[model samples]
Target: MIRTFAFDVGETLVRDDRYWASWADWLHVPRHTVSALVGAVVARGQDNAEALRLIQPGIDPSAAYQAREEAGRGEHLDETDVYEDVRPALSALREAGARVIIAGNQTVKAGALLRALDLPADLIATSGEWGVAKPSPAFFERLVAQADVPADEILYVGDHPQNDILPAQAAGLRTAHVRRGPWGCLWADDPTVIEAADHRIDSLTDLIPLAGQ
Candidate 1:
């Protein structure tokens, strides 16, 4: 009886190849070098922040992110940035009477970017707006309030095992592990993490049938 579906943005609905490339450009390093560094960090179960700092010591993360924002402004998400299955999948869920929303940890400009791209989501929300990030009980509580439903009736779909799957499940929402993004694939083989998700999807299209559409 899932009545609502909340999706994660980055690497779940969209892939930001240029975002990391821009970081490389700012660091004056080869894009592959930076990309590989990020992969290495994730391989060791470290997060992106650790990877960035390891690659460029003394790199001010906020400043680096501001640069990414500047570089990303005019270059909004194009066809390639979005996953091929997102549009059709979201449409199917919406057609099935699901209230589909997108929520994630993103920069303040996320709203603008989402508006510019005009994705299929009925609503888009960010951690910036809520002043809290995922894995915070308050964040999920806010989502429950926003959705106006019991937590058990909501479905949260995201790529991150710890941030999305575990936290959302703990918050009483059925969780879906979308196996596409950095964190998704990184923990794909972990039985503990994988089994925690009520549903597992390699493609967003898989959600269509799962949502009873």
Candidate 2:
């Protein structure tokens, strides 16, 4: 029985394609170019913080990212959604007796996505707050401690194999590969990236059954 669940926000819980497209439009750059910049940096697989900085210089990408999130709370939220099914999915998980929590490896505005979603996150594990990024196992450690759950009883669902999946698996937590098609899985399947998950869900609503502890 899974006692708790930690969800990743960007690609996992919230789907905001237009926001980036808007940026691409604003920057007069191809969306694929932006995607390639991120992909190239991620291919290097450096520390999470370093990776965010490598792709975006000058501004602390993490902090700048969060600022955008904060701004979204007031406006720009229409560009995204927390996934209409999220509430029912989380409610179903709770009905099955699982505590739902939110965690992310955002540079700065990691918390903003959760806040915008207005989900009742029992705990939030953010990379910006910890100053370390994912796949390090540190961010998961913080969230697990904050949620006060035994590692084995907690399940983490995410789109990023390195940032969310592997680290959670290493922390002794069960992992559910939330394969969201485009965002992160464009290269290959989630297993290709993490290769350690115990389960797979193509959508957020699929977690209904495992919410039971």
Candidate 3:
């Protein structure tokens, strides 16, 4: 039985429109341009941040991020940034006696912003806080330890195939691929993603019944 439901933040519980928009503003580039570049990189199985590097060659994303933070324009999340299904889904799962956790590859500031929203989750964490990012076995190792349960009893849900589904599966966690974001939609039908994910969902609400099973 899946006793714990762990969610990925970006494009899973939250929409990333504001994130890319912020970057566009930071770089003084058109939002659509950044969007298109992001799509192109994602289609090529490249990192989403590659779009930024494409915008400004030799740019240091970490340095840019810190500069944005200094300018008071770093990562920000509000209720509007969250998916409509997130609250109800998380609350319902918690109400059903399932452990609800929100963990993903996000900055520490993103973690703080997520907590400020007060979503119905038992725990919220990020890669920055953990000092480990996804697609890494060590990251899932931390998650497994935090869940304090057998990895198979924990369901790791995300919109990224490589970072979420494959790695989580390799770490012994049951995986769910949510087809909402660009990567999710593009790769949803791929044999690899389909074969890796134990469940394919379009919305967080879809997991409500899955938790009961």
Candidate 4:
């Protein structure tokens, strides 16, 4: 039985529209342009940050992120930024005596923002706080340690196939591929994703039944 449900932040629990919009504004580029670039890079199986680099060659995303904060325009998250199904599904799972955790490859600031929303999760963690990012075995190692349970009993859910499904599966955890974000939608039916994911879900609510409550 799945005792713990750990989720990816971007496009899994939270929509990334605001994030991309902030970047577009920071770089003074059209919002659609940045969005398009992100899709383009993801389609090519490249890092999404490649879109930013494509917009402004040689740009340092971290440095640019700090500059955006200094200028009072940085990562922001609120109830509106969350997907409609997030609260209901997470809350339901928790109510059903399942542990719900939010862990993703987000920055420290984004982590803080996520906490401020007060979602019904037992824990909220970010890659920035952990000093490790996904697609790395070390990151999943941290997740397994934090979960404090047999890896097989934990379910790692995310919208990214490469970062979430494959790595988590390789780490011995059951994986759920959520088909919501660009990456999720585009690779939802890919053979690797289909093979790696133990479950394929259309929405967060789909996880409720899998929680075995």
Candidate 5:
């Protein structure tokens, strides 16, 4: 039986389209400004900091400064809409004897979006404040150890193949693909991943049955 549930933050619970809109609004720039920043990072091949310094120029170049500006804006986009259904899914799981936590690549205070969405405090676990990035074995080790649930007893639900499914499965956690959101097209392209997934859901609501309480 699954005793603990962990989730990825960005594009899993946090909506990515809305995240882009907020980034555009905050810097008093066009929507493509956000796109350009991403393109600059991917195309010019620099991390987020170097991209921001090139695109924005005036802002301080610290990691925190760059991340907060982006994260803060994303949270404010669409007035920070919560995943309304996600809450009930989590509540049901918790009621069914699972401890829910989120592990994602994000800045400190990463739970602010979840908090704005009104998720319960304890559900966030040790991730956000601790500043762990994904695909790192050490990050996964620390989170699993903190939850105190054997890897087999935890299910990590996320949307990405690389950042979410592969690493978690390698760590011995059961995996669920959220199946569509930011990563929808990638999922469509690679249906073979279904082979790796223990279960699949279109939305958080479907998780109720999959986790088997």
Candidate 6:
């Protein structure tokens, strides 16, 4: 039985297309440019920070982030910003006696943002808080430690095959690939990648049955 469910944040629980569009606006560039840069980075299997650097070589990321945050103060995720299946799926899991958590690679301020939105989760942990990030054994170790459950009893659902699925599986957690985000869609048709995940889902609600209820 899967006693605990840990989900990746961006593109898993939240959609970030609008945020990137806003970044294009802030940078005074065409929205397509932002999209193209991000696509290029994803094609190369690079991380988000690297994408930002490649898009705007001399830009100051911290300042840009602060500006975005300041301009968007009081702006938090609305129901529409989340995937349609998140709430219902989480509710089903919680009702079924499963512990649900939001675990992802994000800034220190992300916990506050998630709390303000009142997401349905028992715990929320970020790389900033743990001082480690995904694809790293230490990060998954921290999650297992916090969950206080055997690795085999934890199920990690995420979009990234590399950072989320492979690492968690290597760490002994059951893995699920949710095919909605760039990473997920990119590797969706790859036999090796898809076959590695214990479950492949198009919607979060698919997790309900996998969690055994």
RMSD of each: 2.1, 4.1, 1.0, 1.0, 4.1, 2.0
TM-scores of the models, in the order given? 0.91, 0.75, 0.97, 0.97, 0.76, 0.91
Backbone clash pairs for candidate 1 read: none
Cα lDDT of model 4 by residue, 1-213, tens digit = 899999999999989999999899888999999999999998888999999999999999989989988988978888998999999999999988889889999999888999999999999999999999998999989988888988999999998988999999999999999999788899999999998899999988998988762
Instruction: Write candidate 6's Cα lDDT for 1-213 as tens digits.
Output: 899999999899999777677777877889888888887887787765566787678778778888778887322456677888888999999988899989998877876777677778999989988899989999999999989999999999998888899999999999999898777798877786677799898999989877752
Assess each prediction's global lDDT (C-alpha) against the native. Answer: 0.83, 0.67, 0.93, 0.92, 0.68, 0.85
- Off-target runs (Cα >4 Å) in candidate 4 are none
Best by lDDT: 3
lDDT for residue 90 in candidate 4, whole number 0-100:
98
Question: In candidate 2, which residue pairs clash?
Answer: 62-107, 62-108, 66-109, 96-212
- Residue 35, model 2: lDDT of 56
Question: What are the per-residue Cα lDDT tens digits for candidate 3 across 1-213?
Answer: 999999999999889999999999999999999999999998888988899999999999999999999999988888898889999999999999999989999999889999999999999999999999999999999999999999999999998888899999999999999999888898999999989899999988989998756
Give candidate 6's TM-score.
0.91
**Model 5, C-alpha of 121: deviation from truth (Å):** 6.4
Off by over 4 Å in 3: none
For 1-213, candidate 2 gives per-residue lDDT tens digits of 789988887767666555555444544578766655655665676443453454455647446555655765222443245666677777677667678887776534446645655675666556777787677777777777877878988898887777777788888889888767354565336346546877777777877766654
Q: Model 1 residue 200 lDDT?
A: 87
Q: Tell me the number of clashing residue pairs for each predicted model.
A: 0, 4, 0, 0, 0, 0
Q: CA lDDT of 38 in candidate 2?
A: 56
At residue 57, what lDDT does model 5 achieve?
A: 80
